[model samples]
Target: MSGHGFHVHGPHDHELEHAQAGEHGGEHGEHSGMINQIALFTAIIATIGAIFGYMGGATQANAGLYKNNAAIRKTEASNQWNFFQAKSTKQSLAELARDLAPEDKKSGYQAKIDRYEKEKNDIKVVADKMELDAMHWEKQSDEQMHQHHRWAQSTTVLQICIALAAISLLTKKKWLEYAMFAAGGVGIIVGVLAALHI
Candidate 1:
């Protein structure tokens, strides 16, 4: 009543509204199958795209992690080598000192030996921990890559079923059409996410 377009309709308006409603209702029922088909097709494409993207990412991460593990192993080996070299040099110096001095030199030479031992032990511990960390990441990356492959396989099966069901709905099968529409909705959600990189 407050709007400029507002008007009180007579009997003619009531008859026209009823006719239009019936027409639209029948048309909607007929077009439901077509709509479901389009939706299901879109979803299948999205699922495929998502699977590819996830697999590609997994492959890249796996390769990178493998390289990282190799580098970490090499570095650990280098640290171990350096530790042994230093230890040997310290022992030779202590031996020389003992040879050139008298009995009083034993106490001071023992301290230098202890210090070198501590340094070597600390280096070994740190290198071991780094190697462990690298191994953990490499394992995790492999598991994730395998998971992506599994998901891709499962989605392919589901996509095939949905596409076939959508086709079946076109033959005046009302129940199948409704089922297809419902299934297609699930596909769309998964497909759109994969397609859009969500």
Candidate 2:
């Protein structure tokens, strides 16, 4: 029999079947119970691991999106700064013209210089605000990347737990079962930390 793409009869399947059919009724019942428990535990852990893996991927995507936003903001700020520089250059030229021009033209050049100054101030404000926005986006990207790592760590731990569960089933080792549960617990704790953005 097969379910969810996995064959029901694994390497130890025959051994378990023999144990279940043996004359030792009490031992057979206990073995069946252990199998059931392990099967249930594996199912639960696999589901949780899948969720953690999805979360990791989502956080990674968010980090990339946020980083892209930061870059765009930085580029916008740079453009603004370049515009401000152009205004400054124009202002300087106007100042030079004001110094050399006739008395009537001097007032016109001075007005141009004043207008450039005001435009530069406005551009500076916008550029500064864009820079701050870029910084904020960068910070958000860093935070999302950190959370992604936590989710990845949690998923890895849960995968290990699943491996331990398989080994315990194959070897009938109680210690391995306990270790599996411990790993599962640690994986869950890490998932919680990721959720909390810790």
Most lDDT-accurate candidate: 2
Q: How close is candidate 1 to the true structure, as a TM-score?
A: 0.49
lDDT, model 2, position 100: 96
Q: Please, what is the whole-model Cα lDDT of each candidate in the order they appear?
A: 0.63, 0.96
What shift in Å separates residue 103 of candidate 1 from its native position after superposition?
Answer: 2.0
RMSD of each: 10.5, 8.8
Model 2 scores a C-alpha lDDT of 0.96
Q: For residue 57, give model 2's deviation from the true position in Å.
A: 0.5
Per-residue alpha-carbon lDDT of candidate 1 for residues 75-179, written as tens digits (9 for 90 to 100): 776777687678868877976786777879877887787787777787777767777766776675566556445445445645654664656655656576556
TM-score of every prediction relative to native:
0.49, 0.87
- lDDT for 198 (candidate 2): 100
Error of 2 at 138 (Å): 0.6
Query: Which of the numbered candidates is closest to the native, going by highest TM-score?
Result: 2
Q: Candidate 2 on 60-129: residue-level lDDT in tens?
A: 9999999999999999999999999999999999999999999989999999999999999999999999
User: Which residue pairs come into collision in candidate 1?
Assistant: none
